[model samples]
Target: MTKLRLRQLVIAAPGPEVADDLRKVFQLGKPFHDKAVAEFGLKNSVFSIGDQFIEVVWPVKDDAPLHRFLERNGGAGGYMVIFETDDIDAARTRLDGAGIRRVWNIDLDDIAASHIHPADVGAAIISIDETRPWGSWRWGGPKWKDEAVEGELSGAILESPDPNGLASRWAAALGIPATTHPDVTRIALDDDQTLIFQKGEKTMLEGFCVSLQSAMKALERADDLGLKSQGDTVWVGGVRFVLNND
Candidate 1:
């Protein structure tokens, strides 16, 4: 069987303060600063949420891709969807057969990573990362295996003018089939993760959902931090977070 799970979600913010906002709102612990991103003229903080991660990147230079993304979104928004796949060889064949362009890719002894061109996918940059020894993620950094986090990343919501069309495009790129209904189109992934494409003015990775153990406390923290909170939703980094309380 094909083994792939949503491992990380990346967001691009206009400024670094958005990182602080996320940390406070989600009650997240210290983040791992990935020095590798400096090559792209960006700074990032990767926060561990259980086995998953939420990363925020802000552009340090005007020529960065995150800078252009921020300019288009008018602020902070979802940047990429990263997946952990046990079978990279299979994925490579399928993506190549589908004619998807990979903007960046790396093959290492410990991990294999590829960044699919956003224009080919329509929602966000798709990254398929394969780790060597099963669940050990090279990107999470050392000493993070002992860290326990209360929240779990559940899914992401992609806004598109044509939900079914975007879903089909995503399904094609992921080498899966899209299931469409009257309301939204869904692309199911492993670990009960899903990509939900919904009707909107344009195509973009709009927001994501997080399943939190201390759900109420998270919302309260969001309010106390002076971030906008409404019902079961909170606004951070100009993106909506639909809270799923455990």
Candidate 2:
């Protein structure tokens, strides 16, 4: 197959305070570590969510990428989604052949990672990373085994201004067939991962939910931490979201 599975979803916030709030609500244990990035001189906090991660990058200065994103989106929503591919080079070759350009590449010996800009993907920036048995060097955080959650990520629902068009493009790019239901359009990939693109009147990041197995249980756990729950979804610190009921 020319496609890799959706492995992780990333959310970028304006500052570490928002990130820390999310961590507390999601009960995402302590951050893996504090690190500095050369590009924006921003400090980044990485957290684990299954085999995926939730990375919060804060700018050290006024004119950083995180600042730009905050100015554009006004707050947090869905930032990025990462995929795991067995052959990074081959995937890059295919995307290039299709006239896609990579935004950047991370070379850390153990893992090679690259991102295609959001404009290319019709929405969020998509990152592709390949790793050996140990893992990717560019990704340093708590291991998946350490996280209390279980089961592979089922999928993420995205609210889009142009849901139909975006859904079609994603179906082709990710090699997943698109299926439409009464309320939403879905693209199903392997490993039980899916992307649901829903049409929204506004471009706000609200009104979407993540599907997991134990919705009620997860909601209770989140509530114990002063989080709020509605139906099967838990809203943590007004940012992080956890859903056990599909």
Candidate 3:
């Protein structure tokens, strides 16, 4: 099995207002090709965090899947986690054998990607992608290098009623092992990214933790947006965003 690394975080915004609101909180870089995905019934924007990405998807039509997702989750929040795999076909085979269903697939000149149904993963949608030369993503737009900000995605928190069970399933799906702790279970991915499971009544992609190159700047930005901050973490758009300079 090839190593899978966290590549992108997809945030489902209830509307464009919510999307713009979060963009300010993170002080994210220029919006990625938002217009490129319009035909898919989505209004989206992407911000480069180091070489990784954080994308916000807003539904443009009532029938858009994001709309239903927001309603089902009880509100807007984190939606999906996409991992870049070294061999996506192998990953697909493993997932298929385990009875995990793939809801979508994208094969292009620059990238290959697939989506695993949330039912199989427990909460948020999971995607596995393979891009030539890794870190260079065609979907992020041509200016991605210049759009990068000062932080890197450290990991994401997945809240579920059965943390252990969900962790085990995810670990199996990714062909990795889960590290269990008293309060949380961790699935380590390549490039230092981790999927952490925390016990909660509802299964959800709660938040993303990041390591900032300059925490002070991020904190100042959060403050400018009138968002609350305690130490290195801040709650913005109902998500616990951590900014660590360590």
Candidate 4:
């Protein structure tokens, strides 16, 4: 079977404060700073949450795309959703027929990635990648297993004026089916991971659904750090991190 799974999420921040804040709230290990991102006029802090990653990137140059996204969104928020496939050629073939614009890409011995333009997809940037040794991700750094926390970013939420349309586009690109319901459109993946789209005031990443035992404790940490949080959710990088119900 072609194994494709939600592997990582990227958040855009105006500065490094959000990254530090995330570290404290989740009690996650120090970020794996990617020096390669500097080539795009950006600096990044990537955290390992189980096998999944949550990355924060800030602008270092005026002409950087990170700078433009920050300016447009008015601050830190969800920027990208990444999926990894066990079959590289299959993933590429699926994306090729989607008719979406690719803004950036990288090909290496261990991995390859393509970034879909936000304008074509609507909501956030979409990245689909394939890596050697399967389940491994290069952007999370070589020693990412050491930085892992007791949680996983198992699902993502996107809010849009046209949820159905956006969800369909994402589904087609990933070579998955989009199932529509009364209030949402969903693409179900392996291990119960899901991508959901809903109607909202603005089109953007609204939150993540996470699986963790210390979820309430994380909320307390968010409160201690003076971040806006309540119930089973905490606000980080201007997006909600919601504890998974299951």
Tens-digit per-residue lDDT, 78-150, candidate 4: 9999988877677666667677777788889999888888888788998888888788888999899987877
- Superposed on all Cα atoms, the candidates' RMSDs to the truth, in angstroms, are 1.2, 3.3, 1.7, 1.4
The number of residue pairs in model 4 that clash at the backbone is: 0
Using all chains and alpha carbons, the TM-scores for the candidates as numbered come to 0.96, 0.81, 0.93, 0.96
Model 4: residues with Cα > 4 Å off, grouped in runs: none
Question: Which pairs in model 4 have colliding backbones?
Answer: none
What does the lDDT come to for candidate 3? 0.82
| TM-score: the better of candidates 1 and 2 | 1
Query: lDDT of model 4 at residue 122?
Result: 84
State the C-alpha lDDT per candidate. 0.86, 0.64, 0.82, 0.87
Model 2 clash count equals: 1
Relative to the true structure, candidate 4 reaches a TM of: 0.96
Better TM-score candidate (3, 4): 4
Q: Which candidate number maximizes TM-score? A: 1
